[model samples]
Target: MAIRNPMYCGKIFIEKYKDEDCHLVKGLHEPLITETMYYEVQDILDGKKRKSKLTIMSPSMLPLRGFLNCNRCNRVLCGSASKGRGNYYYYYHCSSKCGYRKKAEEINKAFVDELKLYILNDESKEFFKTAIMDAYIDATKGETKDKTNWIVEITELGNRITKARELLLTGDLDGSDYKTIKTESEHRIAVLEAKLSEAPVVAVSPAEVERLLDKAIVKLTQIDVIYSNHDTYVQREVIGSMYPEKFTFENLQHRTANVDFLFQLIYQINSTLREKKRRASDRKTCLPIVAPEAGLEPATL
Candidate 1:
């Protein structure tokens, strides 16, 4: 009986195996390749070494990532990973032909620092608070109940329910009929209750705005740390909330600062900062970039 290499007994068997009786060998010579290399070869053959087609998303980072746009091409910057010498690195890159790429850490730090500075200043901080309050109020503007309409509807539903109950009590209607009417009335009441529950309670008051602003300021001050380690999704959410516009970079030869909606806000907050920074000095100073002016109004919610 021919002794067989155990590794070759299964899928590795040769064409002649069917014609011969094979016996497993008790002892075999050392492997031709190191264990590590053998595994690597197997992985390659099995397509295990192939790059994954899955997208990576970090929920914590969504607050900051999606809002940034490419200064060169005006395209939304997207997160991507690349394999370097022996490790992978993540970066935000412009998807357009301009191909602007920056390390995610670098871009996030620079932007967050700028945001923090804007938020920390008294004038800008106040303006930011007002803007946020305005946004909240606008979001909840239509939630107030039309009392007359609701009263009428509720009364009709109540009467129907009462009639159904009376029919059941007096035996004027069969069990099935009573049940059907009662169920319909109960469903109507439930629907109205749900609508009331969903309605906005009230606009955030001025006092509440002050409290919220304080919290936002604290978070903004630590934005560098928050953004650096935050998940991609949270980073994106922060950015989207801010609604950054395309940054227009000028005087590239001298490394002029990129101009965008947020930059405009910074300028409004501190005009002197632009004067001292010659790079962005040429850009026209505009009014505080409002949500409406920037066309960043949320779609009708």
Candidate 2:
């Protein structure tokens, strides 16, 4: 539950010292967990994680309780399922004088309706997709070379480590000297191996990105289905990821500025061009559908 416990890092501090001097070096001891995992735990503990919005444990009901803020006073609205007659109802209640109140169903529907604005038309979808993939490919162009270099470095380090160990066993190297060299060599090998392992992110393929984007858009188009079909956990995850803060609902609509990136881009692009297209084909669904100009499609959204 706590990430601040440095005990997980495999080393203790030199007490009575300030700043980096207290924990300046690592001890020659085994680690319970990796530095990466330890930092991840720290991020969760520090509330600085990108996923901080969804850090709260999901409740059985009233998933939107902590996600909604009162529009009037800008305070978190508490929600609970209350039994009225033979069924239960959920509501978001204001904490202060605003006395703001809203039913969960209506609020959720409003949010979904707002999300629909971000779905791109077929043409715009193609434009935005190409742009996204092109950017990704450009970014990863150097990863292949980096991976190859890391592999070569790891091989060299491994051979050197083996030679050092041989020298130690043959009495050519003192025990202390062998230990220091081996530790440094092994650490370097580990670091390079890690780099090689992470060179090109496994999920950076264009097909995977497109598929995920399509799925997200499909859900936006069918928000009611998505919300009703999923469990409370999935529902909360979807909402939390879409909006990182407790958005206020005012006069019936959720005042959400933190819509999904793709959705926001689609909405902005379409707003700039007021033209609409007929539903030509199922394959050309969502986003603005416009004819290609000058043999080039406009890369929008």
Candidate 3:
């Protein structure tokens, strides 16, 4: 019987021969793409693409994944793949029954490109930096005062422990009562100490802020490529970190998401670009801003 396709032959070989028995079938017929290429494609399908030697450690891979949402089923979008004709296509699909697929490479590249554009733009960079700093400041507000209160409470707890010990020694309190009070005081002190240690430090310096921004930008820049290399669990983690909501794609062209804050940021930037184009159009016409209802206002008065 004549074999029609090399893939069909490979499938037959896989089904008929075990790994150790593959050598027995080497001379059976001429192979397709060589055994090495076939195996390479299989490895890629199995999600084992080799990494480069120059790769450095990065923390941004999963940090922003949480924020992406499905635009169709409203469920969180998940990474998926399909193999056809010896090639694999990677993409994100809705968690529910709604069929929405965006090629992984395209979406990742688009996200990274947008992030790079944002980072390179002075106004966008400044806005992002300011937002991050404002969030940090807001989170730490009253922390110092809270720490001071805890310190006072810790001291009082220590004093209470000493008083309980004294009472037990003087036979005014029973042994069990003394132990209970001491344990409670120590637990309180321990909790206060932990909280005090966790309190945020003073305002970070501009140099430190810049360093943070640089790191964030680098991670954001590398997310697409890194995610393309990672496995499903890692991809899910990455997506979950960046966007906690779901991404939905309905009818392939129309997409909507509940990510208000992120959508707002993107919309604002897009609007700014559109406004620039509009201004250029207006300059070509040399038209001035028109006042509204100037002639009719006196009639109403």
Candidate 4:
């Protein structure tokens, strides 16, 4: 704790040694770290920057272990392999005494079948493509506006720094005040520049967006095939992306899962169209309206 403290940078403690009360004394036992480096370390210590969670490796054979819940007790189902007659059999069973269990092969095959349900039909595909493209354009518009604002703020900070220097030279501002102004402005400029760098600089052309959407649609349509081909690790990731909540398995069938927003949209659009096509009604069968211009709002079915 003391190594990266302000004292390492030749800061002299005053009174109770509070941060704001400290003084920077030069030629004090040779500075160990730069001022910026000390503050950066302090930020980490203060948790201004978050640490990524440690990932524990799951067994390859039990991809669905943590994702499936016991239907009776609602506890997570654990997977294990049992040996009988010199052969191994894997099963996903309840953690409690519910005695609920299913063959891993059975549940795995059922999950693949579930993925097939999300495959987009031709009509649904056209709707999804149009809607998604419009949404992407609107999102890019917001990002572009944000980038413009950041650039303006950065320019304004630079102007402030220049003005502060001029004031310092004219004796209108004291050295401490001028230094404070420059330091704060430079910090703000750095933050804004970082944001600007992350924001998209060039607008994606409609043709490029269409190409990306084509690839996305291909993957979406072949979700089952893609998932089937993935290793257990990737397959679990695919499941997690599709279904955020753990689902229950009872009577050899998967219970309803609250899927990701995009998949919910896909299921709604595809199922609704299919249902409308099957039903005979005097009213015109209009497709569900999707307002892509609405920012971050789910499409209305």
Q: In order, what lDDT does every prediction score?
A: 0.58, 0.70, 0.59, 0.80
Alpha-carbon shift of residue 138 in model 4 (angstroms): 3.8
Give candidate 4 regions above 4 Å deviation: 1-61, 140-209, 250-255, 279-301
Over 1-301, each residue of candidate 2 has an lDDT whose tens digit, in order, gives: 4456565777555665555445534767787887788788778667877644646554555767687778788888988678998999888788788788888878767766765665565556666666667776677767866777888888888898899889988999999988898899899988888777766565557678778777765665555566668887887877777775567765326344576665566666666554443334433776557754553665554
Model with the higher TM-score, candidate 1 or 4 = 4
Which TM-score value belongs to model 2?
Answer: 0.46
What RMSD does model 3 have? 16.2
- What TM-score would you give candidate 4 relative to the actual structure? 0.52
Query: Clashing residue pairs in candidate 4, if any?
Result: none
Per-candidate TM-scores read 0.35, 0.46, 0.37, 0.52
Select the stronger candidate by TM-score from 1 and 3. Answer: 3
Cα error, residue 239 of model 2, in Å, equals 0.9
Supply every candidate's count of residue pairs whose N, Cα or C atoms clash at under 3 angstroms. 26, 5, 32, 0
Model 2, 245: alpha-carbon shift in Å?
2.4
Name the top lDDT candidate: 4
Task: Please give the RMSD to the true structure for each candidate, in Å.
Answer: 17.7, 16.5, 16.2, 17.0
Tell how far residue 215 is off in model 3, in angstroms.
3.0
Top candidate, metric TM-score: 4
Tens-digit per-residue lDDT, 1-301, candidate 4: 5655567876765554655664555545777887787777777778897655677655666778888888888889989999999998899998787899988888877777777878776789988998788887887878778888988999899999999999999999999999999999999999998887786566667689899889888888878777778787788888899887888765226437678877888888898988887775524555545545655886554
